[model samples]
Target chain A: MNIRGLSLETIPPIFTPFRFFLSAPLSGILAAILLIYSGTDIWLTRWNINNLALTHLLTIGFMLIVMLGALYQFIPVMTGQLIPGSKKLASSIHIMISLGVLTLVTGFLSHSRIFFILALFFLGIGLCLFAGSLLPLLIARLQNQLIVFLLRILYLVLMVTLGLGLYMLLAHAVPSLEIDFRNYTDLHVLWGLAGWIVLIIMAISSQVIPMFYVTPEFSRNYLKMLSLAILITLVSLSLYQGGYIKALEVLLTLELLIFVVYTLHLIGQRKRKIADVTIYFFRLSLVSLLVGIIIWWLGRYLAQQTFYFLLAIVMIYGLAISAITGMLHKIAAFLIFLHLQKLSLSRPTAISLVPNMKQVISSQNSWIQFMLFLLSYAFILVSVFFPQLTVLAGVFMLLSFSWLAYCLFQAIRRYQKIQLEILALPEMKMSI
Target chain B: MAREIILDVSELEPPQPFEEVLKQLRKLQAGEYIKMLHRKQPLPLIQLLHENGYAVSMSNSPSGLWEIIIWKMSDPVSAADCNTQFGTNIIQADVSSNR
Candidate 1:
């Protein structure tokens, strides 16, 4: 636990976080492409096993993968503590988790019980290892009020999601369990989206938004209130599913309104006033959130499956992916900078080892990705009503995802080159 | 005449616990000066001191160690005044020579 020994080389600390960060978005791009290739009609046919697979491709593959990566990076910085497990243990966990995600997605699509069981086993081990590494650091650093509170809540919700997943898998394997799939599935989505995703976003936004823009501190009171409201509403919805749906919807609407206000306030207060690609993503995501709510409201009134499908597409593809992409741009650059800064202290003259983040990811690429994403989304919306344009929507989505993956891959290669430069430094000269 | 007060704090960490260190720095007589030596960059501490109405100057030693000197603005008139008033070397001696 010696501070000096916690160097980058000794721990290879950045590896998993970087890997996960790159992998999550790239997998997401691939998932998006897969959904598009399947055609809008097939993608929206929720009863189809392929639809479930496509959903998990985004949810488990892209969302959870990236979320876990961010968690690993943020937890240490947030708590001022290192991850508990050994490097070997962490690498193994990463491998298992990657394999598990692939297997589970494949199994769910094919309805292969063996793959399902194996996926469950691998994923469970990986998640347990991750939780084990994080939970202790959280407990020891309970003094950081924001971090401790968010981490605790996130962990609990993760457990709930995992539990539901386990039960669903079990139900698939054993019919006698007699669990209602619809009932648990709603709880599962609730925990996954509202609990895990939203809570983490709340926690991270507090730190990142201020830091990135060098803005004045956000109203801590407002953030805390929002967090509490979201947490309470989610919990209530989980417990009282049918009865609390209306109330939950109201709460969600209020939360979204607050978020929009907060985001506007942040942008207004930002030191750098110029528009950035990440900001574009943030704006798109917020718009998507608003649109998704409207679609949900419409679905409630009309009871149309198309509206529900539109809601999912907007929320998942438009909002979630945009926000995640925006975040990755900043987080990846920051991590690379942090590592380089640390390295520079040891090897000040080592061939100028820092990566130019601006060059690594271009605004043009981001804009292209964003436009393609919107085009695909528009196609999907059109297809839901028209059904004929589904194939075209699918094609657009596939192209957008492919472009995103390429952009991410280029960024990662830049990261690797920077790592190599550091490695090439002599032992005496190079810092961890 | 601006006066110099020397504070030899060679034992602080980077982004030094500024409030705690400031309390000791503030106790200097209105015309005295202080100098601190620390291993890491003292940018945060220097900024904190400046914000609290202290005039400060910073230089790095030949070995890349930090030397921060602080003085009350009201007392200093001449370089000689600083040198003779404190009865101690206003200019820091090379510590690497001893090493």
Candidate 2:
């Protein structure tokens, strides 16, 4: 077992994580609105200005936002390592990143050098502040555990990816910088998506699947070696030429295939066969990842430009976003209940008013939200082929994120209201 | 001999595990302490127990699961007996007050 920081105390206050979670979906909602506004033009090619904006909206806004929030919560709770100056530091990180994403999206859509400069500024501070605070702690954590090890890799990847992104943005910001925007942009995307995002997801899911769901543990050595294998392939992709690149791509795909198959195997072995909404999200994410891999293979073999765009859509909206949305539902509900339970520990008489996880966010409501997200996924997949269906896809996407926002809002409201009740108790009044 | 309340929540998910532990605690008698088997250390539950004047001692079982012993501090002997019975070190927590 990966015993590292179980003895450490101090999970950050609930709002520390929730602030990131609540705002992350707004980017998804904005991306959908952009699609509704642009319609067919947004589906034309990945290079289209509005399409680039939409991609950032999902990537930085939705995926990275949720991840930063998770790391804020996870590093402390799982590793038993507390973040120093977390409240002020966390708030600053959130604001900078939220502005970074908005300005980045605006920069993409407007093709303005000034907005690009602003994005570069905001994202730079936000990402640096994040890495500055956590990277040292993660590196210093003394364990041969896979999570700590993989988190180190994740931080390094983020730094390198940020370096590549800086170069790309500088070319736009300064206009005369000696940078091959097209060639290097591909490297930035590869490092950001495949290296940074994919590896972190792999590391976390390996830990939580068994820990939370009563499934068999993923082999620690296997995952560690796989992390190295992916790093090797991504490094090889950046260095190699035409013929060798195809082989490298195959190596990465094989790694993903193993992940999908093994995850499905683990899910099948779950002691409790009753599936939750989070399980469905994972299954959907797995299938979408497989679908993305297939699309890439077909697009490469057939030399069809359209399939590449389809591949991008599947990976971003279908795989990453779907998983994150499901994660928000599960984590937010639990934290609300857990923190409320903490409140009642002080005011023992108010214990009954602190609802269980199910009461906080009903299974039926979450399942319905998951269904909406799946429909949004389908409409988006279809829209890639039929450009006219773009607006309809956008509408469904908006509804899914809006409802996610509502669900989160209600859960937080419950937390606040119950908090007020606990403070108002007769015992509380007398103690005061 | 102190009575034992065996709780094996190795398969239950979150909030359910917390609820089950609390429910089981309410049913305890003066001479009993819970011998709870869990997959991971239930740290939050342990904290709550100590705050409410319950004592806890935990160590890994042969089954590779955590075996946590919880009792009222007034009944420390039962918790100590459990440590001896399970061949675990006695690592008691007594916060006694939340405020």
* C-alpha TM-score for every candidate: 0.75, 0.91
**What fraction of the native alpha-carbon contacts across the interface, defined at 8 angstroms, is recovered by model 2?**
0.16
Best by DockQ: 2
The candidate scoring highest on lDDT is 2
| Tens digit per residue, CA lDDT, model 1, A346-378 | 453552666545556777777787788779878
Instruction: Looking at model 2, give its docking quality level.
Output: acceptable
Model 1 backbone overlap count: 13
lDDT of 2 at B93: 42
- iRMS (Å) per candidate: 16.0, 6.7
Residue A1 deviation, candidate 2, in Å?
7.6
lDDT of all predictions: 0.64, 0.78
Fnat of every candidate, listed in order:
0.00, 0.16
Q: Model 2: per-residue lDDT, tens digit, A1-432?
A: 333334334457888899999998889899989989999997666788898888888888988888888988876655645665566799999999899989888888888889989988998899889888886787574443777777877777777787888778778777877777788888888887778767766766876677667897788788888888888888889888779987899899999899888888898899877768888887887788898788877776643547767777777777778778877888888888888776676564787888888888889889889988989889988887788898999999999999999999999998899989977874431110
Docking class of 1: incorrect
